[model samples]
Target: MKTVYIGTYPPRRCGIGTFTQNLLQAMSGKDDSPKSKKGFFVVAMNDFDQEYDYPEEVGFTIRQECQRDYQEAAEYINLSGADCCILEHEFGIFGGRNGVYILSLLHRLKIPLIVTLHTVLKTPSYEQKEILQRICRTANRVVVMSHHAVEFLEDIYDVPKEKIAYIEHGVPDYKFLQQEAKKEFKLDKRKVLLTFGFVSRNKGIETAIKALPEVVKKHPEVLYVVLGKTHPHVLHYVGEEYRNYLIQLVSELHLENNVVFIDKFASQPELFKYLYAADIYLTPYLNEAQITSGTLSYAVGVGCPVVSTPYWHAVELLADDRGILFDFSNHAQLADILIDLLDHPEKRLRLSRNAYEYGREITWPKIGAKYNNLVKEVTAEQLKIPRKKSIPFDIKILPPFSLAHVKRLTDHTGIIQHTKFGIPNLKEGYCLDDNARALIMALMAYKETKSQKALEFCPVYLSFIYYMQNDDGTFHNFLNFDRTFVEEQGSEDSFGRAIWALGYMLDNAPNDSYSQIGKYMLDKSVPVFDNLRSVRSIANVILGISYYLKNNMGDDVMIERLRKLTAFLVEEYRQNSHADWKWYEILFAYDNGLLPLAMLHAADILKDEEVRRIAFESMQFLSDITLKEGYLSIIGNEKWYHREDTRSDFAQQPVDAMCMVLMFYQAYKMTDNIDYLKKLFASFMWFLGENDLRLSLYNYETEGCFDGLEREGISRNQGAESTLAYLISYLVVLEAHKNYYSKYWQQNQTEDLTSNE
Candidate 1:
């Protein structure tokens, strides 16, 4: 139990100040028990009476609040994590309004109050009892120091008896008492008599003094110390008549030595000394309402034999054994108990011992134990109560892309409508069947990772290639020459394409429809080239070089022929293209991908050192001149798309063109040259970095993302070829985390390089 004393200590005066001062000193006097709280905190009012500090030895902690800011205090209290509060209640000092601040504090704190009422009147005014009633209704328990207090509250304040407790004030320290104590107060140097506290008419000091004459006759040297000031309020309430009257009676008794009028105020320590010096302490109070005289309690608390009022408080505490309670109506008889106790030094010593033993129990340790239990109960209940997630919705893609952790709805699939995919220029009735395209994708899947299925697509077009073959080895022109079952047309141009494709697969394609077609191509293709090996044999040259690509045969026959074909291409047709479908196209386009890629590889492997240099120079030349202004353009000249209704730059650019560019990027990756890498990345940034629409290039139309960035409502080219092209570019950047991040991603600039923008 943490002790929180709710009183007016530092910043004010009145009953609360003095009461709290005494309380703090008593509570601070000893160490609290281990099972109990230790700190004695004071929550005081500040500003007008702030800046007061309590000694640490006194265990005082402070909480401050302004007069009108109790609401703020209440809210803070509600969450303060404290146990219980101790309130000092009084009608006058609270400034009325039924002490609503305390009520507010209790409701917000949700804790109990150990209320100590200063006054419990038998008949209170309307405003007085209203305040008391309000405080009583909110209190968990009430601490009344005397029986009269308990009775007055039960009847006048309407507080329930079960809520009331009687815990009397403890003894003041004897050290203070020893200072003011007198030896001759003892008769035969063995008797001492004292009366102390604020003097008032009803306190019966006059009766005590008058009775001292009879007391001294029995014990002649007995001394009565009337040591305390008259009440400050007595002048207004009843006048100085009582003070003058008591002074006159002291003289009339003619026992000046025995009835000493030491009527001056005393300090806290001095008051205790008078009580300790006395063998008998008397407070024969006449007023019925004086239930608790702190001075009276101090006397009995120090175990001095006491002759006090036969009143509600005296009967309740001094308890008929610790002290002698006498009838105030018979002052003469009340003197007899004091006279007897003074004569019996042994009896006085016994009473003093009882008070000291009991006073030690009320030491702070035991009192603090009472406070700790209350805190444990309140906080335990609070902890048991529960509190509600931060966002609450459905998820599509989960973190980590794992099935165990992810939640997915039931409709996702890989295949989609042909329109959704990227096949451009479809005639409504003449669209390529997915059967043809699916085979390509399936083969592409295998080619992507060499998983044994590119063979499937290789056969799919095998029959078409063979149907175009011709006799005399000149080959088909516009259509198939062997159209025995259909119309006649020839495409000898397609002959070289078909032969090159078939021959490449024949040597190393996984054993399946692909290799069989390779055998068929080789069986028919060599003769067409051997007879002429000119334009038609250009296909032979492609086929023969592929044999070199597939194996290190230690034979130069096919490789020498390929060199001758290259010579013929440069010497003859390389000067100009025949048409859109030109042999020169095949010349440049061969080794366009990794196989063309392997041309250099083959040269390296076979130690065809001259060929390796040629391959490197040619590839580099192609990438350089054709890569227009940081972008790869398929047309050797810019004029190719100039005459069209929609230009390559404006309309849907075919995906294959970008794919070819990525192929160059791949070549650059192989070369590791800064120039190639720089151009590649700059053109690629038209996608999302600091360039062109500064947007998604794959989704680029002539305008923006929609319709692949359309203009004039034209659908932009966002086809499969484009998608793959962008993906390839992304891979290039991703593969070089260092270069990509430092150069572009991190906005780092190099001295020799042109700015990326």
Candidate 2:
């Protein structure tokens, strides 16, 4: 389809210019056939007496402060045989008050129009509101990045909800590796804190500089890197006044050694590299109404943990532990958060992971696809073509399993609890929780690919389990940087997880040596199940026992232990199973699927029909609540689903989605019902943009899944647990699809032979 984009195209030093160029590049990349390539023409916006070495794609140039240029461009577009025109709208980019000059072009445009709004002010002036309203009325579709912008447009600007489409600000798909970039820049040892973009008072760089004194008190070796030159408009008018003020402040605070300024506009790769080198990214912008910040997007994209004032974009992107948000201009709170994260390296690592994982959906390819789809919809509507009712299932090709981030989190001893972005934070020390899950992930990878690399991790993880185990068979969860155990007997969940890992290793160990190690740990941990009181812990133990019985059948002691655990679970279910509430607990929280899944496994091993019935019934109840509207509507971790209270719809986790996939697969296996298989695919598709937000949780580039889905957006953190959950679910889904397709082929062959006979 032929399309024209009106914007400040690149060769111009503006965020909107970069966005327009990126969008065109992505669209062109997606279209492989050069002969039938979609015409992506650009009408560049320029300032008075300003000139750029425009590329061949530019069809026309409109002076920003010129009124007649807009009408001329519109007339040219009308005669150009373009199917649709997409205007990248920013008030300052166009001429006249509130950019009302764009109305002249909109009035004359004959083709379908889609206007992508870069900013939506919550409280717009009368003229500002009217101009936007006119644009909304004139355009076939209005695009916004944040949901808050959509709300503001609809409520405050009187724009209809149907007219607005929420597409996230585009971020480049960069790998989550920071240490190598740090080494390249000779910043391998320093704690690199960064804020990049055009220097402006609204950017609130002064606040970050103010916060640095407190931050440097704890982290004396901290380096605050301020990249990017002053904003072009700020440079043209103010002559670096704000930049001078910031430099003076750094000197006055005795932070000359800490602050380093690179006064130039960084290219995309350079920007990403700088972001990678950063331990924490800061965006202390003063404008709460600011809806989009490309710097923030890039920082989160490269997996930098952010500490920002809660602007509209930051508030949406940094929700759910993805980043820490301080109030606007609150340098003290910013300092406190920075110090706290620096002191507790584990939390910083977690924040970085969250940001990177969440950033996957907002990357250019995904955003471009969303834009393309919207354009198609607009064109189809204009041409009176019947569009498909359901979105086509575009199965994302999963990347080959890489131990890149996983190995980053792991040291010579064990996997650390967190990372600062993708760099391991050794100060957080080691944890059995991650090592246990990592063990299963490695084994699963080895089982599927039979790679020696996957097997190499097995011993490290197995040894970690051995390290955490006590003489009486209990395991410690946390280990400090000095290799000291923090707790005597770890939480019930940790012990149960260690057992689960051991059981998996025993069932699917690559060799006899691994199996022997697994068997010893399994035996040592089996007797500890009698002490587990938490339903999830007991449920986890039951799963481990089921795995054990799968390999070594007719073990009477293991059978009795399994039976006792099953009885306890059944009693719990009976007590809690009311008319509508059919769960083990009053609230449906994390790992809720494990309870029913454990029952399903127990029923198979024990051959108990009652237990099987309860398992199916309870699973059905859980599915009924979670699989609403044919999507995985997870019970929110923030405020879980209580018996009498409303179900919190967000903070839905990858673990929960992974658990549901397992439960559905088991249910389908036991019943041979195709309906269960359908649910399995749907739940699996939750990671692939089949969820409520229509955003993918899986990052194909990083091979990591986002931590959770929040009310505002997906959690950007690509932590160990969430990444493992996606890999596990992905492998299972791959197996199911393989088996399914294989069976169809065999059945079809039989039918052909029978028909010939």
Candidate 3:
């Protein structure tokens, strides 16, 4: 397809200009068919007194301050036989207040138009808001880099959800060569912290400079590198005032030995080199409404551990231990975080790995394909042809296995309880609840990838489990920071959960030592299962017993215990389940799927067909309740569903979605029905924004999932349980895809042989 891009093109030192150039290059690389020889074209935007040596791809040009230039460019594009036009929109890049002059070109354009918004203001002035609304009304599709931007446009600008597409800001695929670059840059011993981009007042370089003195006090060889020259507009208006002020601040703080300035705009190669040489990247921008950040994207792409103020872009990118975030202009917090990271190279390296893995999805090549796909979809919509919605099914796009957040949440003793907005809350101490889940998740991850990192976590978590066990075979759920148990006997749920985790490790442990430890723990916990009162706790113990029975099948004691627990669960269902109520309880609560799932496991282990039928029936009933409108509508925790009360629909947890995936997969296996498999994937897609809010719970940049989905938006906190839930669900989907593809391949091969015969 012939596509044209309109934006500020290169030789102009603008972020949008570089973005348009990179996007066009990537798109052209993808358009390799012989029939499309010309590749993509660009209609470069220029200022009144500025001009670039235009490349061969430039089909036209528009003077930003000239209104008539826009109309002329549109007419030229119409006559140029291009199939569609992509407008790389930035307010200041276009002429007129809020860039309203671009409306003239958009109005006159005969071909289809796709507008990629570079800046989405959360709170806009009257003219800015009106211009954006008009653009949305005029364009076939609007592209934004962040989910936050999508929400702002839909909620504040009244843009239709269908018209907006969320595409991440593109970054170059830079290699990670820190040691080589550091040696080349003659900074072999220095810990380089860098902030690169045009030096505008809003860039917040002073904040980093202010924080550097304290950082330098800890590490004498610390270097704060401020790269890139003053912005062209800033230069034209103020003449290097911001740069000079930052320099003065560095001198005043007595940080001259620790601060260096590279006062020239770096080329792409030089930028990559500097990024590779740096230890940590910093972006302390002042604007909270700032929507897109190319510098931050580049830093992340190269895998530099980042320390950024919580701007809109930073908040989305630095989440979930991908990097460290401090309050805006809070230099003390910044210094503390920086020093802590520098003091601990292992933590810095972990953060870098997470950032790099996350950046793979947003590289220019991947982003180019997303843009191309959007263009095709918009083109089809413009021509009024029916087209299927694009569903992301590529397992490769899933985040890589990184234990950065997991490690961050854990101490030598155990994983901490709740985090205060992604930061580990040391005051809350450790919890048996999270540590149990952590051990299971770590074991599963190790089984799948055989990752040494995953294996390292096993001993720590196992030790925590052993430490929490009381003499009576009960467990303490909570412990203070001082390592003293806070409760005499933990809740039944905690005890049962610990049993479940132990059983899982017993069944899946890679080595004999782990197996033995797991067996010891399971043996201790089996006697207490009969005393559990909560239905959920009993259900959890049943699952544990089922795992134990898998290996030690002839153990009559364990088998009898499993049978008794199964009887109790069945009795609960008989009392609570009726014509309309198909659950074991009057109200559906957290981890509801585990109840039915345990029944399925027990039915299989005991060879009881009646119990098996009941398991399927109840699971199907729950499925019907959740899978509405072909998407997973998890019962919200804000106010759960009751027998006679309205079903609440906000604050849906990741645990719920995760439970459905496991349950549906099990059902698919038991019935050999494809419908269950379809449900499995559909429910998993809830994390990918195939739900009510249409916002993704998964953050590709951090390899972390947000805490939960809410009525208005998603929870920004990426805690342990949420991250583990997403990882578990992702692993299930990956395994299912592998098996399905392998089977399909074999079937095809067999069919070919039959056809040949």
Candidate 1 lDDT at 444 equals 40
RMSD of each: 34.0, 21.6, 19.8
lDDT of 1 by residue, 264-309 (tens): 6666666666666777788878866766667766776666777778
Q: For residues 212-295, write the lDDT of model 2, one tens digit per residue.
A: 998898899999999989988788888989989989999999999999989998888888888888899999999797898888
Model 3 per-residue lDDT at 172: 82
lDDT of 1: 0.50
TM-score (C-alpha) between model 1 and the true structure: 0.42
Q: State the lDDT at 27 in candidate 3.
A: 75
Q: What is the C-alpha local distance difference test score of candidate 2?
A: 0.83
After superposition, the stretches of candidate 1 with alpha carbons farther than 4 Å from their true spots are: 1-3, 10-18, 25-39, 43-83, 96-111, 147-156, 173-190, 235-242, 261-268, 346-350, 353-360, 363-365, 371-757
Q: Model 3 TM-score?
A: 0.54
Candidate 3: lDDT of 747? 90
lDDT of model 1 at residue 395? 21
* Per-residue error (Å), model 2, residue 195: 30
C-alpha local distance difference test of each model: 0.50, 0.83, 0.83
